[model samples]
Target: MDTFKKVTAIRGMNDVLPQASGRWERLEQHVRDWLRSYGYANLRTPVLEHTRLFTRGIGEVTDIVEKEMYTFTDALNGESLTLRPEFTAGTVRAAIEHNLLYDAPRRVYALGPVFRHERPQRGRYRQFHQVSVEALGFAGPDVDAEQILMLARLWKILGLKDIRLELNSLGAGEERAAHRAALIAYLEQHKDILDEDGLRRMYANPLRVLDTKNPALQEMAAGAPRLLDFLGEASRAHLDGVRARLDDAGIAYTINPRLVRGLDYYNLTVFEWVTDRLGAQGTVCGGGRYDGLIELVGGKPAPAVGFAIGMERLLDLWEQSKDEVVGQAVDVYVLHQGDAAARRALQLGEQLRDAGLDVIVHAGAASFKSQMKRADASRAAYAVILGDDELARGVASVKCLGDGSQQAVGFDALAGTLVDALSADGDAGMPEPSAAPPV
Candidate 1:
């Protein structure tokens, strides 16, 4: 008997099986299309970077840096590294490292997995994917509004509704510093009510304490000095500018005073697209202007703003809002019996694929009814059966799975016949077939 223990996927990291991967792919394609429409190019960064890159860029006191980062020491070099907790820091690092902004400000985006050591829940995972979009070296509220509008357009394209926008401005450094001083004093007065987490972060990151979810401290947090009250004129103007643009575009938003994003780098104009459906994880997407992050990440001083969409959360909402089934996997499923018929089936599949059709040729020995059942299970639009008699006659028995219609087409005319039939049914224009030949 086999005695070895079976291994399973690590906790908090789940595999995307075929059943659900289709939805993931569809969402990803929509994201790519939406980003490209705004001229945002793709930017990919390595998953690992030096530990200080995050510690300094994301802030030493932020929860992501202090608690959630997956950090390790490299045995070869005796240096510490971390799987990126978020994309902003790494995107900025890449922009500076490659001098991408030397000629002009760039709009680039990254899509990939991010790592964090956190308890997994529905729509939240230790290994989750993100579509992070950044506009580097652009220093105006217009760009900020543009990013917000871009998100609105995407939601419309995705047919997602009831996801409202909440906006806030962290203001510039001096303004926030003033707010921070006042906040710390307020928290000091309420130290008796501060929970362990709030007390620990009260001084180092008092702004975050206001964001605490502790039910006991809700009243105290609400009573703390609002950051908006302390905004300087320039900071207020920037916020006003963004609001004006959003108004011009007919976008509705609320100025959430406590919407300070959980990052040290964010200053000025932070926003989140939140939904009520996801329960505790309400924020589907969040980002803000981090004007100083470029310099913080070892780049020359430059202004930048960006946002990240948690794919898992976005997908969860997408599944709830949309009901359209994912398209059939293949345009045609070829089934055959007997050696000669199987060979002909393979050849016919290749011919159909050459004319821009997805073809899956059945393999192994199975009865005609069994093959038909397999073809139906594949969700193919049409099934081409090549029995020995049909192979001898140099024709195929084409059956439409959708309408239960069948026709006999000669080998030379099979591709054109199917194409014409599919086009008539409004299912033509199939994507290029896979490079690997049908098995």
Candidate 2:
């Protein structure tokens, strides 16, 4: 047989090792609890879907469809599919296919991995995770304002600072079309200054060209027709409504007229929560009202608004905040010597566990000194030591790792005593396992 070769994770698709998992868990739980508080149920859709779902939803002319989709055809049936680049398109597809909105207007959330074919650097990844929140069948700006406030609350929970919000309105279809014509005319005049990317998107997606990072094109883009100036009465009122609600709640925001959603679907209100902390990729969350998407996806006309947060980037800020996302302190590490005592240690371990303590039964044979060293390494509050002599007397020695005090007690009373000591602060007896440390 040919020699087997070592395989590794594909580039930009990373493995979540033990050390990083604790932070992920903490962030995910916070999202779940926060979503539930707003009565948003969880919805899960497949990661792989028909390629049309995105091309039709995210806009064929956009960078996501034109340059960044991981598309493939099934070898068996020859159907085209692509790893979902974002959650909104797929969520709307599911809602329309299953008639999920028939019962009532729904607020739902989803958390999962999404893929894109792009250079992975710093916080950007080819395979990344997002926490997507969507509210369907409601057309007013009230929900839009609520979603923005909810994000402000999250910053408080994470102790995130130096974050700011940029708000804009894309207007209804007709107004956007007029502005599109005006913007194209302006871009054509400055075609000499436009770079390759800007020229490509000028007529195809004129709005994206406004946000380009090219220092040379910045002034030229700034002189282009402003979309906010083109907003009609209805579009202007909708944005004003959202602004009024945000002001009532005392949330500070800046109105960035150039903050346009390049996709065909987004309309009315769009917003982005940004921070200087993440360097070039500073948009931590972004979304807007996509009222026409449900209809495009084959459902009765339903209005929807939502946003997604990039987990990797947010976790980067979480680390910056110095929040302790690791598991709670270890309660006990059980150490025993001799085969007989090891056998008895198993039972004693269960008894301690039943009394509501975290007990890790030390395995294999090791010297007393080695066992004590491992126990201290565990960072546990106590070390329960069982030896051949202690087994013979039906007693065990417990050492308070915190104070280095040792006491001998009958095996029968050991569990209760440890439980009392650890539970003094009223923590659960059978507390959930904390993040596992590396072996």
Q: Candidate 1 — which pairs collide? A: none
lDDT against the true structure, per candidate, is: 0.89, 0.88
Deviation of model 2 at 138, angstroms: 1.8
Candidate 1 lDDT score at position 153: 98
What is the clash count for each candidate, in the order shown? 0, 1
Stretches off by above 4 angstroms in model 1 are 262-264, 425-439
- Please report, as a residue range, the 10-residue window in candidate 2 with the lowest summed lDDT: 430-439
For 1-439, candidate 1 gives per-residue lDDT tens digits of 9799999988898899986787888889999999999999999999999999989888888889989999999999999999999898889889999999999999999999999999999888999999999999999999999999999999999889989999999988888888899989999999999998899998888888999989999999888899899888999999999999999999999989999965556899999999999999999899899888898878899999999999999888888887774668789999999998988788888888999999999999999999999999888999999998787677777888887877677777788778877777655333222221222
- lDDT of model 2, residue 233: 89
Flag clash pairs in model 2: 356-429
lDDT of 2 by residue, 91-175 (tens): 9999988888999899998899999999989889999999999999989999999999999998888889888999999999999
For model 1 the local lDDT of residue 226 reads 90
